[model samples]
Target: MDQHIAEAIGRPDLIHLDERLVCLRFETMKVVSALAAVRHLLDTGAVRRGDTLLDSSSGIYAYALALACHRYGMRCHIVGSTTVDRTLRTQLAVLGATLEQMEPCSDLKLDQKRRVERIHEILLHHPEYHWMRQYHDDIHYLGYRTVADRILRAVGTRSLTVVGGVGSGASTGALARHLRTAGPGADDVELVGVQPYGSVTFGAEHVTDPEIIIAGIGSSIPFGNVTHELYDTLHWVSFDAALVGSVDLLRRHAVFAGLSTGAAYLAARHERARSPERTVLFVAADTGHRYADTVHARHEEAADITGLAPQEVSDLSELALPWSRMHWNRAPAPAPAPRA
Candidate 1:
């Protein structure tokens, strides 16, 4: 009976091939770990009853927060963007959570500042609501640390190259902190953060390009959860590279992942090339089924490889962008190093 039950549970099959490569699938474990963390937080009085959890997520995190909050008998208020999947919205509504759609503030790119302003407005209007800001909350690290711990234990090594994209920077930052504090087995792990070249806020300031299509990661404003000191290295990837990675994952690994995952994968590949003999790990943030129309659309095949093909569409004159093109890729120059 135990054997039958184990088979039914469907654990990820991990293959350890030599010291250089260790393939570990902790996706299912991650969800369970996140839920367990939520339960622990509720039980330990870190998250009290009747507190309204406010999350600024496009979809996945919103659903996780709603489901967890519902299970714990806590109210959830999701400040969702217009770009969020309708199916996710329906699920949240069914869970009895209130969803407020922030009016698009002259930006096709979901502006984080606008979302934050709406959240502030909601708080001001409803003083009874206790915003469980996931970005800055310490408990957000609880589940993320589990992932890093699992990687360290499974590989049986201290020197690891961890690569992942930053949404709110909660998971990425937490994993970095955990790896830094690990015992003898994980003393020299390096955490690298990847972001879209269009919206590079955490690593290095990049001008937000209006033409770029940002899917999962990258924030319009600097999130409270990310600290520049925590990251060992940062790489900015173009949307074209991310798209190629996404297509490659779908074709080769049969892994349907979102654009953010693609961005991270491409960055990981670059990092892997730098340290070819070392073990590199990347996070598959979410499934790509949600992006069937946008990223996976057959119509975008030609435009997707535009950076490589010169014949691809390049007329921005016909494209309508909400923000001025002047601000695109016009980031302020990096400050000079201090003299010793």
Candidate 2:
């Protein structure tokens, strides 16, 4: 029996959408990382039970860190992006986590920048507070080892393709890294990362999506933990395309997931079609409740996903609008671009 609610919430459900395609759905995915990270900090004497843990988040990570703090007897201070909704705000309050939300802004880059700046300011005020660098620390990867083992047990690593958003690199990167440890057939496990058009993490920063940049999948800034070499391929999915994929997923497979999941679902279908021998498992990071008004309610506006296809590109410079795919081939990270 699990001792804490965080453990239960972190546990993902493996649902087989088809013989070869699977959905690894989470209630709120980052709880795995947050709980493990906090536990590790306490174990290492880097922090005490009453120590305040600080971090910046868009939405999911904030709630995740709060839950972790609640379970571990720590205080959580979150510098939240403008995307943090009222429901999450109330939950954070009840969980005893303090949130410093930025002013409302649609531009993903600006919101992320503001949140980071706020985090730095807070650290200056409280020098003793521990900053849980979720974006840069490898400690976040520790929790996913068990998850990878579970996946390997259910669907052996033979010709396996793990698809998910390239968010902070903890989930997908850690899963692929741990899966590769299962001996012989481990080398066959391929990691395909899905990103938004404006995410700088994979060189898609040059391209701008007219609509919202799908949150949590991609980043406006560079993440140190994102081992670019772990990824075998890349898919830059726009908001409209992700919406269509999300709608199609619900209509067909009954998986009501977030924008990033929709993007991963779209990419997974494409990967599966190309490599029928591979068992494609994509991550559905969270539920669809938060996106109900933004995505599901606009189901009528969603285009027919069957008619869509990604524009394959050889270079980042060639990345286009609705969808684009590139063969990363376990390459090193691209040189950093000058920040605006």
Candidate 3:
């Protein structure tokens, strides 16, 4: 018998796209990570059989926590946004996860805060429920260690650069930290973070770009799990670029992934182009099957990114980012430097 659903969580596919790049494809990456967190809570005696699990998610994490709770015989609650689509709600319903969505906000930042506020209300009313603190807790970081190990074993003796969405800081931040210590050519491995155009984390002007549709990679608020030191460089990818990458990924590799995955794919391509010698690894967090129409109607390939002005570069030493206010520590940028 398959005694544990949690056993099915880790060891997602690591596909070598080419000599220079690979994709860490997951049916849902957070399912793997959330399982780790839940297991830790259980083993540490933080919670028992009767206790309930709770967290706030825009979408993915809610499904993940629900799945984890269902497998572990625990109850789950999700504080979500109005953006919580019918599909996800149905999945959560079947999984027996309760979702309370906050009022819709025209601005994403306000929406996130409202969700947090709702979580507070839920916690106050039901003080017995354990909050997973997906944004603020380090336990979420521990989940990605398995992924880092997988990357290490797959690309032994090669230079590597890990790039992906930095939402809540848990996935990319945690994965990069582990990869740094144990990955091949550990000393030289580069860690790059990708964010949306207006995510407060990267300090792009708070004015949300209508074109940037990727989520789960950037945030309106600073996430505790996203440690600034873990990243060597950061790129703020626009939605158009992410869409381009997403569609291209489907066409070239038949890898169906979400907007965040596309954004990460875009960043990975940028990294690979900058240094063809080093291997690039990026995660495709979820299936793009839901996005069937997003790229299928158009058949033309995405344009090549020039890596020019307004493009995200590693050196904030020269660029003035609103979030960093020029306080971010500087690192000399890797070569093939973009001309001013």
Candidate 4:
């Protein structure tokens, strides 16, 4: 009876990827956010005892919410995305969260719409159930203060650039926003938002399916929190690019992280190569255990992943060049963090 599972959440050990790049392996980041959201509800009497907490998630948030509710003695129900798999189902069951999955759909936007619709239906039937509007709610942003503070502590005030998927606008946006004012390196932190090819967030056409193998990173739907201003530059990663990065991550660092992590890793490499002396940090959003079936490629040859994104493109497939990258602003003055 450890009774401290929540303690394990979000206290990730940072790993060095290169001289100037690091990975914050935040597999449990969602747990931190979920707990913060739920605890706020309970503390403010937003929802009373026995009230079911409901939300939609395709991946880590589902398990994260389940873990939060289980520890807090609150009943939880989840409307999971169509892409959620059997592995997550088993994990959710063990965590005691009730789940109603949407009908499987390939289109990302449609799948998101259907999940929201299902959530509305569930709300209509059970009005008492508290819906944690994770995407749009500012409460989702509170948990990352701890994350930003940790980075500031580990690496003193410096001009650090943070990169990661811009899904709900919660993780990368929230964390970067927090760091700007409070992080030790708050002076000139640049945020680079990452999205898969074809995501509507960065104004790319949805005619072709998004190359996002994992859900929750890129949404075809509008994300109210994902502000364009937050990210100075945007990188649109393709499935092939993410797969390439993921393979290299496993073979090189043995990180075993997800597609989102791979995308961040790729962006970090690109940034690091562009300016070797600057501190570039990225989020390893989750571990890759859930992506074992499709995203990994044991057969691919490994290389020390370097900058691939030469320029942003309208058609990710048409480029047929390398991974896409764009500079949204002039490179800020570099200030390296103190060494351990």
TM-score of each: 0.76, 0.98, 0.87, 0.88
lDDT of 2 at 58: 89
Off by over 4 Å in 4: 1-3, 183-185, 206-214, 301-307, 312-322, 329-340
Worst 10 residues of 4 by lDDT: 330-339
lDDT of 2 by residue, 271-291 (tens): 999999889999999999999
Cα lDDT for residue 103, candidate 1: 67
Winner on lDDT between 1 and 2 is: 2
- lDDT digits (tens) for residues 110-204 of candidate 1: 46667778888888988777666665566666766655666666764455777777656666667777877877656577767766544535422
Reference-based lDDT, residue 90, model 3: 95
The CA-based lDDT of model 3 is what? 0.75
* lDDT tens readout by residue for model 3, 1-340: 5556655654589898877889998887888778889989999999997589988898888888988898888999998977788899898998888888877777777888888888888889999999999988989988888778778888743578887887888888787778777734676777777777666665554434665446788877667666877777777767666777787788788888888888788778867887888889898888886565565444465564343223334443343321121223323322332334
Error of 4 at 306 (Å): 4.3
The ten-residue window of minimal lDDT in model 3 covers 321-330
| Model 4 Cα lDDT, one tens digit per residue, 1-340 | 4465875865677888678888989766688788788888889999876779999888788888888888889898998887778988998988888999988787767888988998999889989889898887878887888888888888643768888888888888888888888834475888887777555666544324344534667766666666667777777677767777888888788889888888788888887777776799988888888776677754254344563555655433443323566654533311322234
Q: Superposing all C-alpha atoms, what RMSD in Å does each candidate have to the true structure? A: 7.8, 1.1, 5.4, 6.9
Worst lDDT window (10 residues) for model 1? 319-328
After superposition, candidate 1 runs with Cα above 4 Å error? 1-41, 44-47, 104-110, 203-210, 298-340
lDDT of 2 at 199: 87
In model 2, the clashing pairs are none
1 or 2, greater by TM-score? 2
